[model samples]
Structure formats: C-alpha cells, structure tokens
Target: MSTTYEFQAETKRMLQLMINSIYTNREIFLRELISNASDAIDKLRFAALTETNLVPEDANYEIFLVPDQKNKALTISDNGIGMTQEELIANIGTIAKSGTKEFIDKLQNHEHLNATELIGQFGVGFYSAFMVADKITLLTKKAGTDLAFKWESTGDGKYNIEPASKESCGTTITLHLKEEHTLDSNNEQNYLNQQTLQTLVKKYSDYIRFPIKMLFDIPVQESDSVETKQELKILNSMAPLWTKNKNDIKPDEYNQLYKHLFLDWQDPLDVIHTRAEGVFEYITLLYIPEHAPYDFYQKEHTTGIKLYSKNVFIMDDCRELLPEYLRFVKGIIDTPDVSLNISREILQQNQTLKKIGKNLEKTILKNLEVMLKNSRDKYLKFFKEFGKAIKHGIYADYSSHEKLRELLLFPSSRSVTEDSLITLAEYVANMKPEQDVIYYATGKDRQAIDSLPQIEVLKEKGLEILYFLDRVDEFAIDMLAEYAGKKFQSISRGQLDLSKFETEQDKASQDKLINENKDLLEAIKNALTEKVDEVRISNRLKSSPVCLISSDSGISISMEQILADVQDSKIKATKILELNPNHEIFKTLKRTFEVDAQSEQFVDYCKLLYGQATLLEGLTVENPVDFAKLIAKLMK
Candidate 1:
C-alpha cells in the first residue's frame, strides 16, 4: 500500500523558499547533499560500535555519484545507516520533528541572524536539494531489516512513500534536474557534467571521512591508437588538516589548506597549531590574516572558527568559541567529546565548550605576546592591520584586559615619527625622574596634539606623552584605568601638578607673576563670564601666550571631539583659560589692562586670547567672523 502526506504549513513555506528564494546559489545543493551523506555514515559507524550484526564488520562505506545526463537525473548513493518507514514519515513529512520550524520563525522575525551557522546547526540541510531539482526520489533500507522504503516528491507540498526492496542497507537520492538549474543552461554543460560534480565534491566535502567516488573515462594507449575505458576514481582525499599531527604537516600544506578554507589568495601572516591530550581532547589550527578584511568592523563581527565534534562538521561560525574582538582570527577546532545531540541553543552553554573557549583565548594571547617580543617588524605588520581590534579586546573582554593591554601600541609625543607606536612600558622606562603621572593627549592630527600648550610645557620638562587619535583609545584606557600602578592623565585636564618638576626659584617666579597680575585676571574674568568656567593664572605655560584646559572633572578636548557629533552627551564641558603670565604678548597685555581696567581694548584682547586658546586645543572658535574682525582691528 502507498501512503501520501501533506507537509506542515511552515514546512511548505520553507520548501518554497528553499526551492525558489532563500538560497542565493544553486551550487550549494551539492554541498548539502554531500554533508548529509557524511552525517549518515557517521551515525552508522557509531551504531556499529554496539551492534555489529547491523552491517558486516568488513563492509566498505563510501559515497558514489551516478550522472544520467540523457535522463536529466543525478543520483547520490551512500552505504550507511538508512531509515525505516516510520522514521521517514517523521523526518521528511513534517517540519517540527526536523528542527527547521524554529529556524524559519527566527529568520522571519528579522533578528540578527547568522544564516550559515543556523542552517548548519539545525540538521535540516536535506531541504537544500530543492534549489536544484524539481523532483526528488529516495531509496533506502535500514540495516538488519527485511523491509525497504521508497519516497518520491515533486516538492509541491506532498510526497508519497511505499515499502520496497533494495540490495544493501543504505540510501540513494536521485535529483531530476530543472532546465534552468541544469548544466545545459547559458550554453554551458558543466553544471551536471562529471567534471563539474567532481570539482564541487573536492571544493566542499574533500575532508569527509568517507571517500567520494565518481565514474571517470580514461584513454589508454595499447598500440598506435588510443582506446577509452571506464574506471571508478576517488575524487576526495577525505583528509582534514587539523586531524593530522603538526610534525607530519609541512608549511606549504598549511598554506594550501588556508587558501582553500578561507578563499583568501594571500598567505596567512602566521599560523598557530595546538593540540590537547588531558582533561579535554581537541586540536585547533588558527590563522592570522595578512591584512584586515573590508568588513572587519561590522557590529555582527563575522565568526571565523569552525567547530566540530568527533570529526563531524558542527558549525563554522559558532561565535561563542571565540570572543567578538578576535573575529579576525580564522581557524578550525575539533573535539571528540563535545556533544552534538543537544539543541544549538543549549550547545553554546555547554560547560565543556566554555572551558575550551577560555583555554583557547589564553593560548592565542600568549602566542601573540611571544611574537611581539621576538619579531619586531612582523609584529608591527600584524599590529598595523589589527591593532584597533586588539585594543577593542580590552573593552569587550574584561578577563583578557591585562593581556590585551600589553599588546597595545600608540604614537608617542616623544617619538620622532607620527606612525611610530610605543607601549606603556616604553613610556615608563623613558619617563623623567621628576614626573609622577603618565601624560596623554588626544587630537585629530599629529600637528594639533603637538601644538597644544599643555604638551609644550611637558616637552620643555622632557616628559613623554602618549597620543590617542583613534576613537577607541579613550575607552581602552578607561578599561585599563591604570598600567603598572601609574594613572593615565590627560595633559589637557586642569591642575596637572608641574610644581613637583620645578625648583624653588621657578616656583617663586610663577608666584610673583600671579600675584602682580591678580587685578588683570579679574578684568578678563568679568569680560568673558560665560565663555569659561574660571579665569586663572597659568602655572605650566612658558612661551605660548595662553591655552585652554578642561576642569579636573570635565571632559577633555579629545574626548569632547569624539562625542561632538552625538545629539546629546550626559557629560558637559567646562574649560579654564590659563594665561602664560610670562610671554611678551601677555606682558604687553598686562600693561594695557592696568592702564584701563574697563577699556574696550582690554575686553577685545580677552576675547581674542580666548579664540587663540580654543584654536590651540584643536577646537573651533565660537564666533570666527567676529574673532577675525577683532584681530584685524587690533592690527590697525
């Protein structure tokens, strides 16, 4: 008797989407079919562990492809665990039993979905066949069972199944090619041709445990003429690189593997090969790309690690294995102990896998620390490509903050070149004996940070400062808070104590200048009441006439610029205008102020000086047009 069934409503929708919509490339159908065949073979091998009578002990298991171009059909056969009639009805006739309904719901909800991982994790890869074929026929016989079953479908939401007989305990799936999806489309016959099938197998399933075989015709020379003979040839090596011992694998082999796996044309900057034998048994091979990809900074942060269990391909984008900041790292991780029977949602919280993630993160970081100390040039090249990502780790992963901090490098106020990157340790080693705080400043360009009056004073005292031009710089520093017990202080902030660096005579001179200009300070303070929080006598300035400084609790100019484009910032800016009190411009200005405490000329000088201070801090003058007129009037 034959039984026909209607697919669940959701399953019907999924079938249509798979057949004519969701999948962008029809070529992936071959890969899906190959993966399913490998999975069945794996299940059979596992089952044979306890039930030897299920199949002969010496039985050979492999995948074979028979192409019938004249009939427009291609059959994929696997000698592995086949399904019973009841299993066929439950697995193929419904969506709920197949774990695909939930995934479809999530896709429809428009969540931040990783389509590749979802499809790989759900165990519903069988549906991909609809993308290439309008009709599909399946023949199977469960091992050690007398009955066989045949299932047929046109993928129009209905399928029929009946009991049948087969020669072996395995499964064979045949696809009736659609005209547009066939090898005959666009004047090309390679799509369903033997050569094209072999190429697809090699590209996607070359590392499956079972050999993939195809029928090949070769020319043999017996005399002066050549004759063609049919031969069965293995198309896949079925060797996974991570499964091999590191000592036996050569560097060229690794390069080739990386090229094939990553689809990257250039060789990796470096590779880290690791294996574990104790508490956790696993092997991982990691690669650092030679350069950053164009989408490295995308918020989703593409996961590059391929996770496997007992050599069964689980997921290539299981991001929980590695933190988001390490998204640039490309690698494969295989473990024999990880359980693949549970749902993907629970698999992520698996205690054993979490333990592996922590250990792997530590291992990768230690490897980087070694490269940094040993290979200066190569390390810089790596840093040039992924420095910001490393720094981002500080903010994203607190557990690895200390390690990530050591790997950070920044352009220094002491370095001769703008591109030179220095570490905090380097800054400490070269710091002045009299300096107690680590000084840093941020700006849009090298010239702007260097021109800050605050930086100039530190430069005169032979103090080193770190330049943080990258937007992430401040957040990284905030995460670290301090390095080796020294606090990171912005030089543009108010009340940076330079008194410790000055001698008794220098202190006395600054004190005398402030005391003499006390009256002039009051005049300027009254003229610019709303422009600045407070008018103060400068203690750090030497040659420059004046400069602006943020309050000890206020936002620095650099941090302000970072958030300047934001519509609203919880932190407000409060700046202090500090006069040099010793520069020649100030000396003349003091004399003019003393002569007429309320003169219009004194008020203009206060406003003009404020404009100059704002410009020096890499900020814009509030009234550029009026400020420019003030300067012109002063010139006359």
Candidate 2:
C-alpha cells in the first residue's frame, strides 16, 4: 500500500529555510550525505556486536557514488544499517529528529557503543542534499529483515512512502539534481562528473573509517585499438595518523606527514601530539616549523589549525583553535564535542571550543618549556625565528607577561659571544649584592648600545646591562615593568644613582664642583633652551665629555624613534644634557665662564657641546655643516 503524508508545520518552515538559506556553500551537500552514510555503517557495526545475526560475519562495508549523465542524477549507496517503514517515517518525517541520538540513549551501557565514530548528531544533515537536488528518492531495507520500502520526497512539504523490492539490506539515495548543478561544464560544479565527486569526497571525508569508493573510466590500449575500462577506486584514506597510538608512530612518519600536509620540504623543528579524554575527547597534532614561511609576517597571511569533527574535515583554518600569538603553529585538532548548527558550516562560540583552545595553548607553552629545559640549542634556534612574535604577547596582554617572561632571551654586557643570550631570571640571579635595579640600554644594534655613555658607570661598577636591540624590545620591557622584585631602569633614559659606590668625600667633592660651575651650566642651558630641558653635572659618564638622556618620566629615545617611524608623526622626547664634571671640556667651559659669561664664544661652545652630545647618543645634529664649521673654528 502507498501512503501520503504532509510535513509538520514547523518542519515545512525549517525545510524551506534550509533549502534556500541555511547552507552557505553548495559543495557542503556532498559532505553531509557522506557523513550520514558513514554514521549508518557505524550504527550497524555497534548493533552486530550484540546481535551476531544482524549482519554476515565477513560483510564487506563501503559507500559508493554513481553518477548517471543521461538521467542527470547522482546516487550515493551504502550497505549499512537501513530503516524499516515505521523507522523511516519517524526518522525522516520529522525535522531535528536523530535516529543515532535515540540509538545511543537506548543503550544501557554506553561504553559498548563507539559513539565517536558516529557523525550525525542532528537529523537535519539529510536535508542538505536538497540544496543541490530538486527531488530525492530513498530505497532501504532493515538488517535481518526481508521487507523493503521506498520513500520519495520533492521537499515541498509532502512525501510518499510505499512497499518496494530489493535483494539486499541497505539504503540507496538518488538525487534528481537541479539543471544548474547537472549542466555540462569544464568547472567542477557538474554533479554528474566523476572527477567532481572524487574531489569532494577526498576533501571532506578522506579520513572516514569505512572506504568511500567511486567508479572511474580509465582508457586501456589494446594491441590494435584503445578501449575504456571502468574500475572502482577508494577515494578516502580511511586512517588518520593522529587517531592511532602515538607510540606506534615513528619519527620519520611524523616528519613525512608534516612535510606533505604543509608542503614544506624541510623537517619540522618539533612535533606535539596530544590526546585528551574524559570530559571532552580531542586529539592535536602540532608542528613547529624549522623556519618561518616567506609570508609569515605579511598582513594577508592567514593561519590556524585544521579542525575536524569525528574524523570529518570541518574547517580548513579554524581561527578559534589558537590565539594570534601562536599563529606560527601549524596542525590539526579533531574533536567530537562541539555543537554545529544545521548547516554544519559554522561552529558556535561555545564553552567546548574555548576549553579546547585553552588546553592547546597550555600544551604548546608546556612543550616549549620542556624544550628550553632539555634542549637549549634547539630552543634558541626556534627563538631566533619566532622570538619577535612571542615578545608581542607580553606587550599585548599583561596576564601573559609573567608566563612568557622566563622564555625571553636578550644579549647582555656579560655575553661572551653574539649567540650567548641571558634570560631575565639569569640576569637577576647574577646581580651584584648592592644592585637594587635591573639596568638596560637601547640603540640601533648591539655595537651602538655598547658604546652609549650612560652605561659607562654601570660597567665601571661591574653591573650587567641588557641590550635592547629589537624595535619592540623597549615596548615589551616597559610592559613587564619589573621582574623578580627589581624594577627596570633604562640606562640612557634616566639618572644613574651610583650613590652606593660613592663615598662621603666623593659626594661632597661633586656638590662643590657643581656649585662652582653653576654659572657655566646655566649659560649652556640658556643657549640650547629649545633643544634641551636642563644641563647638569654628570656622575654617569666616565670617558665621554657629554651625552643626552631623557627625563625619568619621559619617553626613551629608542621608543620615540620607533613611534615616529611607525606612525610618521613628529614626537620628541624630553632631552636632558649631562656634562662630565671631571672631563677637560668642563675646565674649558669654567675658564670661559669667568672671562665672559654672555659672549658669542661662550654660547658657541655650548652649542658645540650639545651637538657632540647628540652624536654620542646615536642622534643626528641639527646642522652637520655648522657643527663641522664650529669644530674647525675651535681647533684654530
């Protein structure tokens, strides 16, 4: 007997929305149907373990794709568990009704069922096929049953179910595709093309446990003529390396997988394979490349981990899986705990994804910590290529500064070679008993920073100074503020309090010298009022006559330069001039001050000293030609 039924009012509304708007991409239709077929097979495998007679002991299981160009139809057939007449109406007649979900609920001991292998959580996946097809016909027979049935629907809120005949216990769905999808074209959109079917199966269902096979026409050359031969080929690999036991995987296999997946010829610097179970089960296989990609720093470069749900590829670049700081990381994350809407095109912003991201971040950081502890050389090499990106994390978020602080490395005054870098903890550990602050200097490079006059006093006192050479080094350090109870002090930006090394007599002598040369210092300050904030006697400079330093609360020279370059704005730092009191230039200024305090010669001497100070601090003079002329006049 044939029966006709009208879909529920809500089912009609949802079906229209799904067919017209829910799915954003048409290619996703094939993935949905294939996932449904895979789930059907998984259900049968679970049922056969309890009911031995449900299926033959050595039954061959697979999903097949057949395209008929003449009929303008594509058929997806699977020899798995099928539904009876009542089961068909109950599962397919209603929207959002999942047979797999009900099957899992009925099991007394859920452990007996391998739920991870089942892909269909919501029954709506079957409707996705309607996106490409105008009508669908389904023929099915339940396992261990002789009765068969056929269900037909045009997706217009009506369907027909009737008794049918079949020789095997399985389900086959044929899609009467729309004209646009079936039209012959050179593009891959043609639904009846074998190449198009193979591509879609490999992209979204390559890791399905049961083989997904398709028939292809291959040309054969006989003795006198060429003939076409039809052969069946398995499209999916059916095995994901990350799903297997990590112990069984070899090191060479990991290297090859990384190279093939990422198209990188070189072996990775390291590989991290993690499996988490219990509350939420997931597997992560990550790789740290030996070197960064050519476009790693380009603005258009995209990055994220490949996301999979139940061995089915969900998204190629799932940005939610990793933070921007870890963008250099490349890998895949497969989990069955996430919630997907009807289209399966977007992942909801749920707690499951957030927890997985947090876990992955912690795992990567822990792996780096281990590498740093056990493999110093390898860690340093990795740092050299990606250290700037790591430093960005500290500046962008204060909460991560402490976590990433220990992993930071910088070259210091005590470094024996270029590659010898010290951590903040190491610098703090080796601090002198009298040292109360962490001192650092910034310049264009190590050599420029090494020659700065402000750090001369620290070197004389046997204190180590960290060299901030990278453009972001100063900004990142400023964000850190302090480490190990020692506040960061920029050597070239503020006053150097070497009072711990000064004696009572030395203090008194410095005060007397400043008072005696008070007139000379004021004359110099008045001359360069626009260029400097103040002129003072220096206890910091040893071999140099004068240098420029920023006020304690003002921006450092390096930071000012970086901001100007990045923003293209004219922002200047508050400059303070420090004159070495014991240098010969001081004696010459004092002598001239007594002779004629307001003379042009005295003013000229002040300008010359300021120009020289600018050059010593790695800055350009306002007028190099004038500076040279003044120098020549003074020499004559």
Candidate 2 — which pairs collide? none
TM-score against truth, every candidate? 0.70, 0.65
Q: Residues 515-589, candidate 1, lDDT per residue (tens digit)?
A: 877888888889998888888888777678999988877566667766766545546578789988768888788
lDDT of each: 0.79, 0.81
Q: Pick the TM-score winner.
A: 1
Please provide, for model 2 over 1-636, each residue's C-alpha lDDT reduced to its tens digit, 9 standing for 90 to 100. Answer: 989988766666556655655333576578777877876886676567557898888998899999988898999989889999988887788754333334334222342432111212223567767778999999999988999999999999999999999888889999999898888755577888888888888766775678998889999998999999999999988788799889998887677566445645467899999999999899999999888765677665567477777775556677777777788898989899864221223464666887999999999999998998899999998998888888888888888886799889999999999899988989999998988899999888889988888788889889899998888888999999999999999888777787888899988998898898787788889989899988999988898999999987868777777888899868888889999988898888878888998888888899999998899888889899999999999888
Residue 201 C-alpha lDDT in model 2: 82
Residue 122 deviation, candidate 1, in Å?
25
Off by over 4 Å in 1: 1-212, 220-226, 396-398, 566-570
What TM-score does candidate 2 reach?
0.65
User: Cα RMSD to native, each candidate?
Assistant: 9.1, 15.4
